[model samples]
Target: MSFLCLHFTRNIHIHAFYLKFSRILSTQNAYLNRFVVSLRPLNN
Candidate 1:
């Protein structure tokens, strides 16, 4: 029973970590996209 509880808590922690990491990744992607768009005129 204790092992089951530990496993459950670990799953929750991993889920939360993934959510946070994904959010950061999405924001970084947006920033990179904007940066690339800004450079378009210079490249032309």
Candidate 2:
């Protein structure tokens, strides 16, 4: 029973970590996209 509880908690932690990591990735992607858009006029 204790092992099951530990496993459940670990899964929750991993899920939360991935959620946070994905949020960071999406924010970075958005920033990169904006940067690219801003640079397009300069390239032309």
TM-score of every model versus the real structure: 0.95, 0.95
Worst 10 residues of 2 by lDDT: 34-43
List model 1 lDDT by residue over 1-44, tens digit each.
99999999999999999999999999999999999999999999
lDDT score, residue 4, model 2? Answer: 100
What lDDT is reached at residue 30 by model 1?
100
Model 2 lDDT tens row, 1-26: 99999999999999999999999999
What range of 10 consecutive residues in model 1 has the weakest lDDT sum? Answer: 32-41
Q: How well does model 1 score by local distance difference test? A: 1.00
Clashes of each: 0, 0
Off by over 4 Å in 1: none
lDDT to native, each model: 1.00, 1.00
